[model samples]
Target chain A: MDMSQYYGLFISEAREHVRKIGESAVQLEADPTDRPTIDALFRSAHSLKGMAASMSFTAIADLAHKMEDLMARIRNGLPVDSSLFDLLLAGADRIGAMIDDLESGGSGRGDSAALIARMLAYSPGEQPAPPDREVVETSPPSLVPPGEPVGTTAGEEWGVPKTVRVKTDTLDSFVTTTGELITVKHRLALLAGSCREGGLHEALRDLGRHLRALHDQVMAVRLLPLSAIAERLPRMVRDLSRQLGKEVSFTMQGVDMELDRSILDLLGEPLVHILRNCIDHGIEPPPARGAAGKPAVGRLSLSVARRKDQVEIEIADDGRGMDPGAICAAAVARGVISGEKAAGLTSHEKLMLVCQPGFSTAPAVTDVSGRGVGMDVVKHTLQSLGGSLAIRSEPGRGSTFLLKVPVTIAIINVLLVVVGGMTVAVPLTAVIRTLEIRRDERGNVDGEEIFFLDGEELPLLTLGGLLNIPGGDGPGDTLAVFVAEIGGRRVGIQVDRLLGHQEVFVKPLGRPLSALPGLNGAAILGDGQIVFILDIVHAG
Target chain B: MMFRLRERRFALEVDAVAEISELLPEYPIPGAPPFLRGVVNMHGRVAAVLDLGAFLGLGTAGRGGSLVLLESPGCSLALLVEHLERMITSDDVGATRRGESRLLPVELVLADGMAGLLDVAALMDAVEKSA
Candidate 1:
């Protein structure tokens, strides 16, 4: 058998085993007596060693064998020490580097001899003293079920091959072809309306139904669980907490929630950035937290919720929270915003000031966040994906970073509104609700036109004026507007007319047009007219 | 390849030419610079059409023109020219005794007259910076 043909599979599986070993090590560190986690860590190391031996990669196999031997010792009633977990993590990292080398077409050769020697010489009875910090009463929950582990699904044993991998480009093309079919179906429906003869309308309706089914199936195939991107997060948080010398308990909910694979691909880095911010800037040291009459250990959590077509991911931390006044002062001192302008900003807006480019409230720059450029990139990335970031904090309480993103980026529902004869689309995620308010119902608040919706006053601004387009004068009776949230406030965007709603395939803008701000993408309508999808949060 | 954009001729490398087609109906882009002639649905992909004359600070390339689509996979962009003159071999280009112009990349002394060879990549960089 030509083992060369199986190199890709070997590298991929070996990586999964390595990741599992690291995650299990972290879990075992949190609960030293957890029998299932200890067994899991042992199994992962054993599996990795077997895989490496089959591939004849001596360096990797040697390192994995040592890790397996250590895990065996721990499984056979040897006491678990903190340094043992570090040794395990070190072994995982060394194997990870070797796998990376192999993936890059180099020999999986690395100098793990020192690490192996350390693992071999390790004695579980020689326990080191725990760090001088107040240990919390509660331990963080296990990231995944011990029986299933992080990388494996039920019935997906090694060499069993219950599922096959499909290339991402093939999936992408399927979406593109399906989207084109939907557009053609709409065009046919338009033509069918004119011909009352035969069953053209009925046949077109059936075609539309079948096309909708195909579109739904394609989108469903593109959906992947959030756990796919979140595989390394638990280990990452654990390592960073130890590095920063902070006793923090981190937990996550809704990791199994599914989202578009494309969205998940871009979302991982932003999620990492937010988590880094939480550990670095949001959480305080044990001494400071104790001095503030809080628990010695800080609590950090990420909770995800799906609402309609959008997903809200909230990352929260219980520590010495943000002070809006201090952030405002920092923005003024950095010349990011004028002092006069900062005074008029709401507390929520002041919290958002941390996302401004070149803005950092950290007293001194650290290696972890450096100059604090991550938040700005995180904000820009979310906005580019037609999502928004919001911050809520109290001076002494915790702070929460809310990220709102669409479920999928390929095809989405949009409310078509005509602005200045030309039509534009507002992604349904951004639209709160569409309304028609009579002229008499309008109110003037602080010399600005406002509309009352559900007893809440929202400022009304014309879409034409916002886009600098002309000829969007209303009928002088009722104003057609849709409520959208911008900067944590609801505003009524007035357009010429409402063209109802439709599901359109989104195409990314190319070149100079892509460089333009406030536009998310372009979509072609049934009439072959191109309309720009408004990034409503950034448009104004 | 040489093309005319408002009487003044501009030359682009033959290898850079993906396609040459008559004008397609364009839709206006909101919040875009004026020089952007808007976008067109090229096949199934959307391509931004730039009025080369206006972008070069001459004037609008105006109503009727041919689109010179660039062969850049990353950017589906096209340039509007009034008329295409002719395609010249690389030998002709190399044999030309012309000096590089400070305004554009280089000035190619063609059989008709002196035409500035448009560097699409550099032009794209400049456009991105300004836009």
Candidate 2:
């Protein structure tokens, strides 16, 4: 038999077995005396051992065989203890490692001799279990006659099923083809601009619309529901709760919200960090919670909702809320902020201080939350993804961190503007409002341009002046002032003209252009011209 | 050192070259020091670009040929230069003794015995008042 034919089957079977083992082990740990879960775990191990032996995978077969013996002993009413649980957990870890090795094209070799010896010691009186009980139990004298090599049809029933897996190169090729299609559309638009026939131009416009819709649909296929991420959290919470000796009931909603897979991947760590903070810091101890007239088991809720073009996720914990006064004091002591400034801050501002790097109000270092690198990292991670993290808390009530993320990563709607001779693109989401310069406007006081908007003075900047572009009317000409908020401060930008908005595919400006502070990436416009995209946050 | 005031050009050391781009004009911001050329949109974002010529005593060069974006760790601004000349590679664009010009400080003295190379970075630092 061709070994390649069985590879997929082997992998699928192995993964299913491992997943079952992991789930059941977690369940068994939760309720150590649960006979049903233990029996399920034993059956999974027994099946895996049979499958491995039939496939001639010696190491895996040996490990599964040993695990099966241990399970059998436990099932037979042997006293179970924490040490046995630890050994079982160790076995599970080893099995996971072996699976990883196999997936990576290794032979799955591992040193499980000691583990097998330990298992054998527990079942000293019994003969080693037969490799196949099904065949031995009812010697059904059928077609292939008991001892013959029934390799043809009989093996198919036990074989793993195959699934289609496309190489990344194929995906890349598809992307390149779509990009070319977009470029072709741009060329057509440019050419159509010269034609005067209204009917032909309208037809071309319709074609462009259809093509764009098709492109969007193609991209949407790559988007997966956030449930892919939400599904794993329940198990994670379950395991962490057991380890921390706390009762945490985690609830999730909006798991079906769809987002680009890339964004989902990047979001995992930050989400994990937030969840850990909730379990480790936010949730109060059982005794403390009971004394406070609350349920002994703390509740952690994670939810996702689509807001316009953005996704808002909230992770809330009914734990001891953050104390603003304590945070302010810590900030002052750490020299992050002066005592005067800390005192002057509002409660909201004080709560935000907890997200500052190296800021922690925990009394001492613990395995949980005291390392001081939690919330700040979460904020930075979200910011890097062009998202924002906001925290709202009330003392003794609870805490909630709201994360706002864009729905898609590919195309962004940007406001085009002319700075000197260069055309730049600014994401429309970042722009607050655009103002027109008037004759009576105060151009510059001591060489600084200040303009009034809504009866309040706002500083105005020129596109030419900021980028060192010459040939500007010295802030006197009719200017288009663009207001943008950066680092919690509102800044106004004056441009020579405000071009309309455009949907542009952002392409990263390689290492050569990364050093520029304000420029994030660049995109080729409909006219095949390169326009630089700005990073508003990095501008300041 | 080389500097541009309006249409006039002066020579500086070549070490001063920081960056060159178009200028970003800013509205007069209240309470801000002079020479802070408001703010400008660089690429897709807004940045604070300074006017090197106005900050330095070189007089308001106005908008000249091209904007020279310059920055040190503490100071950054855009200066209007007439136009960037051809790259001159010579063994010696000789150094000059320190001078007392308001715009050209003692540290910005150019090489005297030879045609001075453009010192875009130092001139920007001298003109920058923020740092």
Candidate 3:
């Protein structure tokens, strides 16, 4: 019987098995006696071998068969060692390549002879010494973070799946349709306001509530777990530490946390860059760590927390923290800034200088971080997605990189403000507070306007001036303003008037519009007017 | 398609014409170049409107004209033409003349006179570079 129809299914299922084997191998390396992970690794390999055999892909079957044998040996009282993980990972990677070849219309054939031989000859005799007590003490608590325990299948009954696989394009169109529906609903609400019929008003209110519920359900379907892109990060950390002669105890806390798939898609590269930076420059060699009276194994962690409409991802490492003075000096030397300019910057701003292009503190270029190209790309990527990146570090306590991003970019709540007779929007996430400050409350110091809020002095800037428009002339008894952080400084932006807030569907700018700076996206108002969303953080 | 931005006439290939419709309400794009008239909500998609008169240094395009939306992928841009003269096939024009500027290099010979064949791709590129 022809099996061409099953090729897509076989490839997808085979890919899943390969991913599971890789993930379980990494977990087993961290804890050798993890029975569930061992069982998972063995089962995935066994299933892969069965599928490859049925499909007549002998090269893949041969490699998986060897890996299954090795897992069985460990299950049958054979000692666990470092060689076992290397062999299993190599087998999974080889099978993965074969699967890729198959997807490209090849016969799924590859040269796996050396890998198969390694798996066949694997043993504990030549294994290095077992993990020392110090290393074991520093290991992560468990795969699951506290307060969220992993569920077990032992006590649960088997039932039908509660989910189904829908094409990503279909899901995207659902969001678009839902967003348009919301827009139409708004149009209806606007039209209904002119009529004084009580029944029409009541029905419009009900439609609004129903649309909100629909939006929630659609957004939930679009969310993908952070683990979708974070699965292979552990293996990467392992390989890099081994190459750099360093020992790192890496733990990830919120892999199960869900975020929009669009954000997740762009997130993988930045996460990889950050992890590489942590291993290459942030963490020190074991010997250097020992000399500094720190633990021989450095600690690195990635944690995620969801704020109202945003998510914050924190990547921290316990290694040599950056020296703000050194960074400022380097900036001066690199001509990225002047000596006088560097002297006036705060420590936080000094650290941010690392994100400037062509700024590299690394003494020698290596294959790892690629000459300080990591942080800037991270900052740029987050900014393009309407996000921000912040850094904090001490002299010795290590450094943390904080990344905050919106949960989804499709629809958002925006504060509508009239700037120069033209209505514009500021993302609610970017606004700290809105105030009607009295003219007497403002102070002019050194030719710059300043205002005090909560005892913190913030510079006052006109929104119209920033956008190169007109009408910031109202310095009357009171001024309308909104506070936002721009270039690491809190500034009160003066606008013509505050027109309240509304939820609108965001549409990405294309071509000439996309090339324009200082705008995040465009949205249509309920009255059929288009408003440009201001990227307040990055706007000039 | 032949269109007039101001007194000057320009022509784009019919294959690249997505839609020709009456001008819609437009919102100003902050910090954008002067040639970029603004953005308009075309159906549900937002498209940038380029004033050809302003871009070519002719003059600001007069309002209340038609918008010629281009069918280019990844670019939702419309040209604010004062009037869409009519659709003309390539057979009706002679093109072997390359002008100084690549944007309007090819010219079409109509019954009245010669009209420049606008290179939509080059125009988009120029907009990107300047914007």
Candidate 4:
């Protein structure tokens, strides 16, 4: 096989491994006694070194090899103090930089002779005194037994040998075909209206079934188990903990849950930001944890699970939870939120205030946290991917961030409506409910138009008025109202008529019509007529 | 080389020509520049679509019938155009010295024609700043 074809894959995989090493190194520094974490870091380095060597990425190869040797010594019972962990972390950073250079088609070069010499100096010549017996007794059961052979020695018995390799172009083609299919389906739907016969109905039904099947198959092909991404995270936590002089134990579950590839890429950065925030702010120091009746080392866990058509990822920590009052004060001090509003907010709302841009509760900026860039970017990124982020916190019990994202972006279930003679589609997931109202029943409450539904008055806005479309009827004898929620606010949209539900491929509206507020994109329906899709948040 | 802004005509650099298509009205995005119509789907990717008439101080009072897609550093965008006149390459096209032409907030002049070159980078910066 031509090695050139593998360069992209190699670079991506190497970067992942380096990140894992950073995380694992952090965890090892936290405990300095978790042999399993140490072994994991060593394995990551070893694999990365081998891959880099094969790919002829000399800088990455050499640095990973040196780091692996150092880890080998530590794994052989040699005590690694904070300084040694720092050196390992520095090596991890170098590997990361080299990977970045490779990504940009630059030769990785720098002065690293001194660091390489330092790594070489650490030798596993003799084992140090065994860990105290009491420490061993209390260690987690998963840690390697004191005298177990390292590396391949303990894996043959239970290891599964399976590897399936598929060309990247194949996946790319699959995505493209799926996109085209959506367009064709929309065109067919438009044509169905022009045909008037039982034969036309039968043909339309057949086409619908075929399109639905194809849509599901395409989505499945794009879905990958979450473990492929989560596997490298533990290593990352370990390395980051070591570098920052903090102890953090990172764990993950629900690795079998699957998600769209695009979603995984969208999720990567926000998850990193959240993890860094946890280490920098959530995890308390050893002395602090001990004083608070918690373990000396802080614990962080990330779990992913499927809920209906969406995936839920939870990142939780067992450190000192956030104090909403402190956050509110910080927000006011930073001038991010007004003092008047801060005073009136509930605790849950206060906690969410941390996600506001430039709002940091930290007393002062540090190397890791308090840089004025908080969870706001995370929220924006998630929202752009059609997702939401929620925060839950208790005064002293750490914070948990839950991110909900859809499985795929290619095909969506939408509620079709008519405004100003043009067809529009709204993602069904974003719609709260739909109602019919009469003009006489539309009442003004608190200076806003409201409609009573289920004993509650819902605020309403005319879709035509919102989109600047003319010729819309007033809330008269019959009004169709579509209620949608975005960013925690619910708003009712009054449309001329409800066109029912559809599963359509949403094609982005071309350049000329891009500026219409609340319109995300357009789709060609079965009859070849283009229908605009609404951006719920912006519309609200 | 011919440029159409609302009803007025101006010359544009033929080399600057990329691709032109029909305009599709896009949703208004908060914090975007007044000139930015909104993002439009170009192929499968979302591309910011700019209103050339509004961008060049030529009042965006008339409906734009065409779109011109231009390339940027990391991405490309489409600009609404009313009419794309004949392309002209001429060595004698005179240069309007700095300060010779009124400095509109978002227009740049070139030799082939006075067609307003869409300043996408500036527009993006303005958007970011407002954001």
Each candidate's DockQ: 0.76, 0.04, 0.77, 0.21
Candidate 1 fraction of reference contacts recovered: 0.78
Q: What is the clash count for each candidate, in the order shown?
A: 0, 49, 0, 50
Interface RMSD of 1: 1.2
**What is the TM-score ranking, best to worst?**
1, 3, 4, 2
Off by over 4 Å in 2: A1-56, A61-92, A103-106, A111-163, A197-203, A338-346, A369-373, A418-422, A429-496, A512-520, A535-539, B1-131
Query: Interface RMSD, candidate 4?
Result: 7.2
**Angstrom error at residue A217, model 3:** 0.6
Candidate 2 lDDT over residue span A1-540, tens digit each: 555566666666676676677667766776889998888877777766766666667788778867777787788786666556556666767877887888788987799888766555543344444444311211111222212222232235533435445544565455545655665677677888988989978888897798688768766766779876666576677667777888998888997999866678789878887887888888888998998888989999999999766799999999898988888988999988998888778886788898887887767877756664577887766665567777888777789988877776556778988766567788887788876767568557777778887787676766565555553554555767788865454667877678888777765433213344466556666665667676655454
Better of 3 and 4 by DockQ: 3
Q: Provide the DockQ value for model 1.
A: 0.76
**B81: Cα error in model 4, Å:** 4.4
Q: For model 3 chain A, where is the 10-residue window of minimal lDDT? A: A133-142
Report how far off residue A233 is in candidate 1 (Å). Answer: 1.5
Stretches of model 1 off by over 4 angstroms after superposition = A127-161, B94-103
Arrange candidates by lDDT, descending: 3, 1, 4, 2
Model 4 residue A236 CA deviation in Å = 4.0
- Over the stretch A1-540, how does candidate 3's per-residue lDDT look in tens digits? 687866877787788889888889999999999998988987787777777777778888777877877787788777888888888888888899999999999989999887766666666886343223111111111222111212223675545556555779999998888888888988898888889999999998899899999999999999999998889889889989999999999999988888899999998888888888888988999888888999999999999999888888999999898999999998899999999989989999899998887888888889999664568888888887899888898877789988888989888899999988899999998998999999889899999999999999999999998888886656568999999988667899999899998888888888878777788888888888999998888777
> In model 3, which runs have C-alpha deviations exceeding 4 angstroms?
A1-8, A54-56, A126-160, A338-340, A371-373, A487-489, B6-9, B93-95, B105-115
Task: Tell me which residue pairs clash in candidate 1.
Answer: none
Q: How high is the lDDT of residue A237 in model 4?
A: 73
The best candidate in terms of lDDT: 3
